[model samples]
Target: MDDCTDRATKRSFLAGLGSLGFIAFGTAAGRTSAATDSQNTDPQPGKGPFTDSDEPEAFVDDVMAERIGTTTPGATVAIVSGDTPSLTKGYGAADVDADVPVRADETVFRGGSVGKLVTFTAVMQGVEQGVLDLDTDVNSYLGDSTVTVPDTYDDPVTLRHLGTHTAGFESTLDPDIVADPAALDSLEALLTNQQPSRIRPPGELVGYSNYGAGLAGHVIAEAHDTTFEEYVQSEIFEPLGMTRSTFAQPVPDDQPGNLAAPHVRDGESFLVADDVYINMRPAGSLSATATDMAAFMSAHLGGGAVGDTRILDAETAETIHSRHHVRHPAVTNWRYGFHEYGNPDANLLGHSGATVKFTSYLLLALDHDIGIFVAYNGNPSEGPKAVVDEIVAEFDLQQAPTTPTPTWRSGGQERAETVAGEYSLTHLPQSGPLQVVDLLEHLTVEPADNGRLRTTILEGDGRQWVETVRVRGGGRARCPGLRGYRWRGGRAEYE
Candidate 1:
């Protein structure tokens, strides 16, 4: 209990980093009155009060109203429930300097890593077309390109590994953002020059890599004999009528609608910041509007079709939402191109994204047939994710966190002692200037009374955990919401 409390404290501190500012708006009275009244009158004991079919505009308005103009200059939001857009709205300013108000239908915000969903969608389309295989060596499709995945380990890197971020590529934490759009190289050139060395065996670990994402996009392009942008533009954006979305960096001057200017906090005000270009377009270059995103989300929620325009068949869409990689049983894990949001037990698939100055988050509640997307013009320590978290919590889109029952094993103390130690996340950069992030974020585990273990980070409060044997020779240690344990070289690592 002490450990869970401390970890919550740590999470609070981390979430504060991207906190957004907002301007209050007139409440949409009676918008959700039906749902609110029912929820208040007949509350369920263990479920979210609101239903998936409830009108969410009022709730979303309240969430955004609290943070406009304080952290981000402007923001866009989209919510789709049961194959229809319930709300698509914009608030504050897209360019505070020019005093341009964001229009949910007209203003474009960078989707950041949220765009990876589109890239991965294209990959699935190829799979449906029999042009791509998730388990095949990625090199098989890269024969026309200069890039190649070296035989760094016994198992060759596969599309599945890349999609799951388990390709073992060292984390560079960069998608090659450049100051000048002119400096941006072709997708092929950027991937060839900036490829990171594979540091572990394929599928052995989950190391989030921009390189891996870019590689996946390059593979799709190679397989289809098309540029990454061109492939998605035809298969995804055009089919779904996402006219305001594009992976072209600088967002094509001729593209319709205005681009939302990125912002930075300036005391109590905000200053319009320069927008950078993504060299690896496939990884994080997508710029889109809330309205366009709503359509995209609806397509997924509607089983890969938005009003009869099908980008993927039902089976392909389901496979895309299925779990592809798991780092732990209790916490968030990867699902194809998307990662699990909040509770792993919850049937929610999501991904968070950011450029240097913009941030965005997208989530799909598969069971509920609902999808939420939010993006901000300014990258704060806490941004769109906070809004998504609040929506999920309010709607009961997923199971809330709960205390885990301890396995009353006979020899917990012995196992606890065997696994207690300071360890770093293997997915973090192992070598480079960014390696210090691993050092600062490393975990320190200490045995506690009654065979429970206490774990602390370099700076956060200690968390309590219990041990259970998950495999014949491996150990499983879990906290309230986090769980995973692996033993290698006589060392203990937790995820």
Candidate 2:
């Protein structure tokens, strides 16, 4: 809590926007490790002290195999201990048509906005070197004088605000696949022409914004007098030896060989989607391998450097993770680009990535010196989330937030009344054919029996997460057995 930025609310809203984690996944529910154990015994090469068993990797191996069975095809995973990747492997085919199997070391998957970690690291480096100021208006470094912001709030959006997703910009891009490179627009052009409206004041509300993050990347690029792609390549990727990664859309000419083709599930199988390009590559559209991401993850795990190649100094790394905003204590909050993910009891930070077809997840148990990453080429009915959850459960969480949950009728009901309403966020499509999704943005919370409240928080996209939530203090409610998520009135909030 070192001068922790803004406080309170849910990190899940960001995840709802396709970014954010903690106490990680909910309980395994009907899925059990005991059942998975009997299904597959694919063992790894090493063991760790996470569990009391002699074969610690056994649980993870079993879990991976079982979970992959539920997916269409192709997932690469990596788990690191300290600066070393203790577990790294692949499952199924990279291209079912080509019959090419996925290789953990070579196949690439879109990192999505998790690439914003690289973007934020670059911005923070700018702050460290006095090239930029975190608290100053971003328009100053934007290099375009005519670009104007909607006069929605008195405060201007700043670098720190973008890092924690409090820039208040509405969604300007759609989840529709940008399959043609010719359709791409420059970052500034995208910002200028399709400029999103600033719906709230800066640094006040926490809404996961791809536009805000992409703008931060643009600011860093302008500060360095370079393109965002060039700046990251020379500063972050090369330093960390993440050679198999690229922000360039249309899969750079020399690297398309390594790119994993996007796939979608039709009933019980994965069908390859056409190659895609994203106009807002800064927000999403990063193609990388799990092995490459592990190197990036290892750099953070080892305090911003790995073997003399330093992307960020120790202090810069810590400052980057410093909390910038929280809407409720019940849900997780942003610490710069990462989230206070996993069990609140355990010191963890991570992000999740999902494109139209591909999905990825990253986790760093900082205190335990562990980093885990999983990326898949296809969207599955079950999703790859269960895999990450099982991995998170391996860590020893020390009874997160030991305070007993205050039961209903004991002053919690009064708090529920004040919070019941229709809350909305800005993650919806602003002006696309998909803008109809804006209807999905509004969440209605009403008091249920026994002092609990109910709402359809996030039920679409293979999720039924928000059904019932227990009222907590501060106009917030915690959905029992769910990850930290609370709602009220804020940027990504309900009224």
Candidate 3:
């Protein structure tokens, strides 16, 4: 309900773009809980709160209602319990100037980086058909294409690396956004011209890369000898019967769904604004309704199948959900295209997304067979992820009771001192004008009392960490307030 930033006219589009990069990295799925018993337990038909219930829908309704006009001009939400679509609803005004209300099945909202899931799903499809291999060098697929990965290191960039965000593409923080739709170029041209240098070896570290995702889509298209949009439309969306989803810019007016008008906050109200086109379409240019997204989630929860149609085999879907990259043993890691939601052990997977004026988030509780998707027409500090966090907590999805047990391990203070320093996220830009954002995102670690460590960001949001054990590179620590919230010592290194 609080204003995220100044409502100045100057802070409308570009200001939101500045935070888009960070929003992609936001983990609003659940609290870091150390509870082990229920984290891995699968939900039975009548054994849990989420499956076959109206409680989750009611909770989501309340959450969306509170955030509708204040946090975002309009929002749509979808929840899938087991194999059934439990809830699909909309809130607030879709086009404020026209006084149009959102309709979950008819109103389309830009999905931003959340579309990376669809792109990666296509990659998994290629893998299933034996047209592509995860570990195979990506250059092999671009045999006649204009884009090619430069051999910057001994290792070749592979589809696995791209899906896991370990392809090592240099960070630019911008997804080739253009004001005019006419300025958008072909996927191959965009990839070739804006190719980022590989700064790290493939599969080395988990640095988020929009280029990596875009290139994955291009590879899929080339392998199928078709365009990205066409392939997904015919292969993924069509098979799943998702008619309201498309990766096309401007969302073709003839399409059945009504595209939600973008909005900018203006002194407790919102004004309609123009939408920008993402040149790297596969990475962030999906426009879908909540109803269509429900089908997408149902397919994933059903192990790549929905009813009689199966886009991916059960084995392929399992592989996509399996861990593809590990940031640390204690913290969240990357699944094929999705990332670990809360506790790595919790088995929750999700992704957050943002465009200049829209924000969205998706989470799948594999253990509970529940999928939650939310999208907003306006990008605020508290966006769709905030709604996701509330739903996650209300349902006790990935969280556990916090009961602190102090450790008496030797050299605790010394280990804490070793991690004490100022650091920045690897995903943030290290070069270009966007590098300025890295300055503000620095996480400062300082040794606290009783061998605990304190982490404070430039925004002064401080979290306490208690050391549990020494790991390979450094030590592992968890927060006592929320048990099981652990992270590797060098989560952020000195900049």
Best by TM-score: 1
Each candidate structure's TM-score, on Cα atoms with residue i matched to residue i, is 0.88, 0.81, 0.86
- Model 3, residue 19: C-alpha shift (Å): 7.9
Model 1 RMSD, rounded to 1 decimal: 6.2
In candidate 1, stretches whose alpha carbon ends up further than 4 angstroms from where it belongs are 2-54, 468-494
> What is candidate 2's lDDT per residue for 89-189, written digit by digit as tens?
66666776686777777888877767778888889899989999988888788665345556577888788888887787765545224657788878877
Backbone clashes counted, model 2: 17
**Which 10 successive residues of model 1 have the least lDDT summed?**
28-37
TM match of model 2 to true structure: 0.81
Candidate 1, residue 174: Cα displacement in angstroms equals 1.0
Candidate 3 lDDT by residue in tens digits, 1-495: 111111121112222443323233211111111101001122344555555355665676667656766777778888887667777877777788887888888889999988999999999988888999999999999989999899999999999999988887877767888889889899999999999888777877766788898899999889999999999999988877789899988678788888999888766577788878888888899999988898899899999888887888999999999999865555566789998765567799988888878888899999888898999888776667768878888888886633334568777787677667666655667788877876776667788787777766666646666654343343544332211212335445321
Q: Which tens-of-lDDT digit does each residue in 155-272 have in candidate 1? A: 9999999898889888777688789878989888888888899877888767677788899999988998889998899888887888989999778879998898887776667777
- Return whichever of 1 and 3 wins on TM-score: 1
